[model samples]
Target chain A: MTAPVDVSLIVIVVVITALVFDFTNGFHDTANAMATSIATGALRPKVAVLIAGVLNVVGAFLSVEVARTISSGLVDEARISPVVIFAGLIGAIIWNLLTWLLGLPSSSSHALFGGLIGATVVAAGLGAVHFGAVLSKVILPAIVSPVLAGIIALTATYLAYRTTARADSGTVTKGFKAGQIGSASMVALAHGTSDAQKTMGIITLTLITAGVLSPDSGPPFWVILSAGLAIGLGTYLGGWRIIRTLGKRVSEIETPQGFAAEASTTAVILTSSHLGLALSTTQVATGAIFGAGSGRRLAAVRWSVARQMVVAWILTLPAAAAVGAVAAWVASAGTVGIVLVAVVAIALAAGIYAVSRRRPVTADNVNDVGDDAAVAHEPAVPAR
Target chain B: MTIDWASLGLVSVVSLAAGVAVVVLVSFALVGLSARVRPRPGGAEDGAPTLSAGAGTAIAAVCLAAVVAIVGFGLYVIVS
Candidate 1:
């Protein structure tokens, strides 16, 4: 990497690829923070995304601690080449687009980490993969974070309904709607502080592998700014399809339910990250909405849709890892391998985008009648 | 390495406590403020006892301020 100029080019491609993943991560997760707000009319579809976009950029600049861990603590960074990273990024980006096209809100963090681990195992040996750290940092948190979030949201939703039972219904709606704005914004801001850093971590690890930065160095200013801006722009675009799935398909959220879900999301995300555990914001938010929906009546919730999301969450890691393993095997051939992976990834992404347009779900149609929504419930599946 | 169940436990406990506190306080604030609004002719609240304006405002203010403080702490956790 020090002598070969091609390695630097690969590093640049890896950085760009990481930003693209960040972009998908942003739109893929817009549902997590803004879906409830949009669903309950607390904020207009456009305004909710606008505020989330701005808060995400502000939040990205707030911290770098998370970036450091993803760069060094997860794997033997010293053994990885920049091309390995590029392959991993491609795997992650492909999975993200595929899930988005289906309108399933999968865990982007799991995909990213899975891709990296897969590439590392293929490029380096099994010894280079730190199983202990993966177990503690990745596997355990995935199981624990969402369940904890769901429990908190369930309790919060019950308490809100019970306490406000005697109040005027209209008054309750108004108060909770006002409260929704704050809680949803907190989740958005917390999202920025958390998910944005994962990209920064990948880029920093790339720089270190390429010999552009010393070992253990944090992400440079340029890396942070680009990651933040890319995510912010994507957030503004809004993932209308997934938003519809979570907000409308999962349950018809009332203002009180929306506030409970968003507040629980904020609390769990902030507390977990503060304690040096960066759980998937997507899982936490999804579980909160599920819990909020269940708190009122089990009959109202569309359990089938919730079940679909759980299946997606379960498949995210292994699917991305499989793709990443194949890509890493190809990319080991040197510059030819990197370019090949990049071209194939771009083609697949473009294909997914094209297929999504067949039954477009923009902000306008995002909240149509729930009986036959177009999100993933469309009985026909075109080969994605 | 053994799983750090204790850290996970701490996150669950603190998040639940903080999340419930915020929701309850906001609900109370809503109840108190609604109690201050004079009952309209044929309104649903016509039969319920309305709190005095002073007591209603004080309760609403206190409850809302507590929510704000909790939110402020959340912000601190993110930034600091």
Candidate 2:
């Protein structure tokens, strides 16, 4: 058995790391909610992110079901330790930063799950993970949700165009821009409820492992508030790199397509959250934008950019898992090992940040697609 | 463990239907409002059709209300 002081110290470290992961999750996914709105000029980038951030905080308070699932459903809490969760968070944080630097909106959800599962396997063996739950809850939904969202968005976009074809173009554009605001707001709220809970679950599980909370206990009030605030603050910072990719690189979205895509994403994400399916909002939004782009004209969609994003999605789980496994192996050696891993992770994050500063993507320049030759050449939007 | 196929199916159906329904409704609203200009009995002086503030306004309002109701239901799902 571990000494009380050691356990408490590790628990604090794990909790802090979990919040760091939550912060990354927020900025990584901000694009999912506001990209379309910003792309179509429905909302200014600064205002869009601010609204999303506020709604995210409110959305986090509305549900705890997803948090409960994370705390108990994915892994056998009895066999794992807080140190393993810490290593897993480190893995997730690294992957999120790497993907963000590349402007690839990969699945932060999958990264977290992979990190936890990988660390658990390294520390407690494969049996510690509930394979059935991972297959049914995680894997199946990941395969289905995006495809489902895509199809729905495609159909919706087609119908929108058909129904509005005879209407005055100026009026139609104005009306859909108004609709986009409401739909995108819903996506932000749904994102908060779904994504913020993952961090809460990890922290709750850590508390349980540290013997500070009972098994099967829900996330405490403080955990919920802190997780919500971390993600909210991150969202306000705005992940401009990914926002640019989803907003402009994938498609030259008109107001109607933006409205349709955002509405479809909100519908799919909220329903999945209610059913307790932890899905990637990035995948859903990307799929919806692709659907909207294709529904208008197959050739209009930038297949090249979409393909690159797909490749990133495929790599997220395994790449994060590999990192998590290595971190866990090092951390299990002792306290000194944990500190070493933390130092190395911090240095790597700093390095990535320094590299990003060279070609910084901020809200002011997020819509500048003219610099990207591959996207600029597309016929969708005329290069400025 | 068995996959909860029922819940999965339910989510798929509801999301698809709601997504299509909302966009279609919004489009119809825009159409109703935008199509309001009818050619005057005598051709307009500037060749621009005059707005007929009649059934079109009513139809647009109904469609817009339906959208609001759907959005409200979504909020209900989150809160409940």
**In candidate 2, how many Å is residue A123 off?**
0.3
Which portions of model 1 show Cα errors greater than 4 Å? A1-7, A369-384, B40-44
**Worst lDDT window (10 residues) for model 2 chain A?**
A1-10
Candidate 1 clash pair list = none
lDDT tens digits, residues A1-384, model 1?
133354567777888999999999999999999999999999999999999998899889988868887888778988988878887888888899999999899999999988887888899978888889989998889988888888888889889989988776777899999999999899989999899999999998988887877888888888889999989888889999899888988887888989999999999999888877868999999999988887666565677887888899999988898888889999999889878888889899999999999989998989874456543453322211
| Candidate 2 residue-wise lDDT, A1-384, digit = tens | 332464577888998899999999999999999998999999999999999999889889999979888888888989999989999999999999999999999999999998998899999999999999998988888889889889999999999999987667778899999999999999999999999999999998898888887888998888889999999999989999999999988888888999999999999998888888888888888899999888787777888888888899888888898999999999999999899999999999999999999999998999988888668666574321
Q: How good is the docking of model 1, by CAPRI class?
A: medium
Q: Worst 10-residue stretch by lDDT in candidate 1 chain A?
A: A375-384
